[model samples]
Target: MSDSSVSLRPGSTIGILGGGQLGRMLALAGAKLGLKSHIYCPDPQSPAFDVTPFKTVAAYDDEAALRKFAAQVDVVTYEFENVPAATAEILSSLKPLRPGANALAISQDRLAEKGFLASKNIPVAPYRAVHLLEDLKAAVAELGLPAVLKTTRLGYDGKGQRVLRQPGDAEAAFAELKPHPLVLEGFVPFEKEISVVVARGVDGSVRAFDPAENVHRHHILFTSTVPADIAPGIAKHAAMLAKVIVVALDYVGVLGVEFFVLGGERPSLVVNEIAPRVHNSGHWTEAVCLTDQFEQHMRAVAGWPLGDPRRYADVVMQNLIGDEVEVVPGGIDGDTQPHLYGKAEARPGRKMGHINRIVRSE
Candidate 1:
């Protein structure tokens, strides 16, 4: 925000505002290019802190800490979309926040993201905003039963959302869900879900990775497979859709654009949602592609030349959830790469690590 014209050179420090797995990976990727990273996070046990010695354990709203962080780093970026708008503003005022505040604003709220995409003539599921019980009832009447009611803000990984199958389910869901504003979306009977990870540079250059088919268990992403059986034309179109959204936002850095495919061999697509940072679905790129999403993101944010995103293998990336962490040690596989996040507690539903298994060199 403060300096879009600024380009960081090697040895520049990039400040990252989240200390999850994504932040940890970003730091590692930056180090490969002679770039240093400073991580700022509230959690003392943040996994990212394990990799980078430069860290500030402070609340995001601590403007004093944020300013001090900005003074040390050349630019700022975040690993997650739920970062507070005020926090983004504080950082942006002092240094350029890659992907900018506009991208964060749209992605943090479901209603805003859907509306922004729809404005560009992109296909999204029919949705309506719900502010009250009566609003939810009216939305159900209009959009019909079997719709999804989700909180407008801070919802991710299947949290803060519910399905209204019966007429009486709406009230229960509304009462259970906190925060007044919500969104009700018509359910699409899609055959498959896919995602394209795209990167936009400060110079207005854009490139996209191949689309990957996604499968979920308990609403958490379980696996992502490259060379999704969708037709070649569909894959091209998915990337084009991602370009439209990224260009419209004037966003810099990496974005994860998800989609829903209907029909069989001849498929029609709908834009599901967009993540303004590196995504779980694109994890396969780390093992298969010469220029993975993590490095691509670093290149974009630091104003370096974007790396080629061509993949060299047919790969399936799988997440190790909770107790599944133990399975990796007893592994037998071909070209399997294990990436474990250094977290001590493997709580249920928590993402402990992931694997990128190369099926064959392509």
Candidate 2:
């Protein structure tokens, strides 16, 4: 792919799937570049709809709506991984889809994702595929106890997964989950979780942000600190691994690679998963870097040169999940950069918004 192949003129419309906060941010970024955004989501009150110029409040399977949206947009991109494969195919036939539907299809399933990673020589946790009782038993024996059983599809924020510490727990967990294609992965006992957010342009140009160490609570992201406490060489390796995956996928847009960092003299990093869109952990880049992940994504998909991923300051991004919004008034007193997604109601464990705080080092 060449730079000249994709172009976003001043009035070109960018179609976004899944109108969440990521879509909202991507829409904002497109506006800055003199492009318009038309958000497509089933939710009537999606936050992204507030900012975008056009919105289609129809189901993903609504072929008529999908065709109409495809006709109006110059290029299409998605905010979430769960966009149906059929929906992506329909949009691709009508207009160019950024990051491509192949990335979505692979990342949406755990088994396929891990297989692709292993095929590319990327190191992921030892895993086995499970579809039945015998398969679970075999996976338990191979991957061993203290392994996690995750649904092959639609699992996120710790949902659709359970950890088994011993042998007997598998059947009950399987019964509770009840007949979903699953993957058993040996538990990775590591120091911290870290992620690399990289953007690959249509021209094959790649740029990656500094690795950020992530902390999870209730299997959801809690905090992310940039310039993670890892050796520079190891951090560089993490970024390189991310770039490799992006290029191998022929990806054009922002993608995130999560890793388990085993702290020690060697400090090995193991691939956890890949997010084929701007990640929540990279939110700090909005305030602390030369280019935010959202803007970089917009630029890349729009066929612009990848921006510099240089960080201007050390930063920490804390997610405002659920009732945490109450603390916003008190939290804003400091030098914190607060970003509240326009979610009307905040339920437990739901990601309401996030705030980024920059700490300068003398």
Model 1 residue 272 distance off true place after TM-score fit, in angstroms: 1.2
User: Tens-digit lDDT track for model 1 on 74-115?
Assistant: 999999999999999989988899989999999999999999
| Candidate 1 residue pairs in backbone clash | none
Q: For all the candidates, what are their Cα RMSDs to the real structure? A: 1.2, 1.6
Task: Give the runs in model 2 whose Cα sits over 4 Å from its true position.
Answer: 1-4
- Looking at candidate 1, what is the lDDT of residue 51? 93
Q: How accurate is candidate 2 locally (lDDT)?
A: 0.90
TM-score of each: 0.98, 0.97
Candidate 1: worst-modelled 10 consecutive residues by lDDT: 327-336
Q: Report lDDT (CA) for all predictions.
A: 0.93, 0.90
